[model samples]
Every structure is written in C-alpha cells, then in structure tokens.
Target: MLKKLFGLTASFAALVGLPAGAWAQTAKDADPAIWVVKDADTTIYLFGTVHVLKPGLSWFDEGVKAAFDKSDEVVLEMIEPDAATMQGVIIKAGLSMTGPGLSEKLPKESLPALAVAAKDLGMPESALERFEPWLAAMMSAMAPLSKYC
Candidate 1:
C-alpha cells in the first residue's frame, strides 16, 4: 500500500511539472497554465496557484469563486505546522543554540547596526545571539510575512 501510494504521489508530482525534492520551492514568475486530459469516462486536471499573495487583490472574480464552489473536493499542496509542532522542530534543529554569538561573529563595526536592527524588530540583541547567519537572515526576511501569516 505504501509503495503504491508513493508511486501515485510521484506520478502526480511529475504531472504538475515539479521534479522530486523541488516541492518546497516555487517558480514565482512562470506564466500560469492549466492542463487537462480527458477520456471516455475520466478527466484529470492540473493547475497552479500562487504560493503567496498580498491581501486586497481585485483579481479574484466571480468566475474564480464559482470554480472553487463547484469543485466537489479540494486538495491543498502544503501543510503548515502549528505553533507547538513548530517549536518542537525549532528545538530539534537547535535554532536557539547553534554556536558563537551573532554579535561576536559579526565584525566589530557591524555590531552596532545589528543591535539597532534587533531593537527595531523588538528583539533584544542577545535574543538572536545563538542563531547562525543563514537562520538569522531567514528570520529577518520573515518579518513582512509574520504580520499577515
């Protein structure tokens, strides 16, 4: 059963133009297209949705709402972990205790800027001390998304 399910999943992933291991990323600028295959008694459709959209867009028209309403079932492409699960994963990943302090890792000249940014973000400078550079960068990039998400 597991093998059959995995094979079915791989086939569907390929149908959607995603290679294996690329499911977590998206091509943001691709032209949108829908593919359909139909036979005597069956039909399969493949479509894409934008990964992230800002609020208050005027593009979702009545036709779009009707298409969604007419569908018998819907499948979402991703699963977001709840806060507790996210906390557990963060703990497992050691995001709170990686290595040398971020301030110490930065050049002496950059510490003041880092501290200022941290203060602006309402984070104490010491709070981010243990995060590696890449993690710190990702967190900073998440500030905009954090508001609506």
Candidate 2:
C-alpha cells in the first residue's frame, strides 16, 4: 500500500506538471496558470479550470466571471475537487513522506530563508524537518492553494 501510495503521489506530481522533488522545498509565489481560458471562435470561448486549488482564489476573477456570464454552459477543468476529494488528496499525500526531513533538504546553507519562512508558517526546525518536504510536496501538487493564499 505504501509503495502504491508513493507511486500514486509520483504520478500525481507528474500529471500536475511538477517534479517529485518540488514537494521538498519552499517556492516563491507564482502566477496561477493551471487554469486558463481562450476563445475558440468569435461566438465561443473555453475555460479550463484545473481542479488544483480553492475556488475562492481565482475562480471568480473578473475576467473569469465575465467570461462565464458571457457563455452558456460551463466546462470545468476535470471535475473540480470538492472538499471531500481535496481532503482525501491532502491526507494521503501531505503526511506520508517524512523520514528524509527538511534538514537534509534545506541544508545548513539555506537555513536563513528556511527560518524566516518557517516562522511565517509557524514551523519549527525539528518539527518542520518531519513536515516540510511533505507539505511542500503537497503544495506543489495544489498550485491553487498558493493562489488562494
């Protein structure tokens, strides 16, 4: 089960267009483009909502709402993750991988940024060592989470 779970995690990482190692480190804020919309014709447009974040983040952006109001049926990005599904993904993936820890991943050289970001996120070094990579990995999968925050 653990092996399969790990493989599933890897598969999900790839499916989301991120590397497995992306789970192990803190990333800077980046524009969310996991979801996109483009015009198919003068009378039609397509909205692709990747089910990777909280809808509260960018789901109702002026442009997206305007596009929705302009259109008829809504085509979502693979059915969006409801609270339950999102919770399953979060639970299965976030706390699974930890033995390697953040200390090894962050290195003594990068301690300063780690310290600051850790404080901001309320993570202590030892506790974070157990959690950092897993949470980071999960975030990399859910690009929308960062967008929401």
Q: What is the TM-score of each candidate against the true structure?
A: 0.44, 0.42
Off by over 4 Å in 1: 1-52, 58-78, 94-98, 107-113
Worst 10 residues of 2 by lDDT: 17-26
Q: What tens digits encode model 1's per-residue C-alpha lDDT throughout 35-131?
A: 5567997655455565333333233344444555656666667564554454445435534455578877778997787777666445767766765
Q: How high is the lDDT of residue 28 in model 1? A: 34
- lDDT of every model, 2 decimals: 0.50, 0.48
On a 0 to 1 TM-score scale, where does candidate 1 land against the true structure?
A: 0.44
Query: In candidate 2, what are the lDDT values of residues 55-122, reduced to their tens digit?
Result: 32334445655766887676544443554454466556566364666767766887776666555443
**Best candidate, lDDT:** 1
TM-score of 2: 0.42
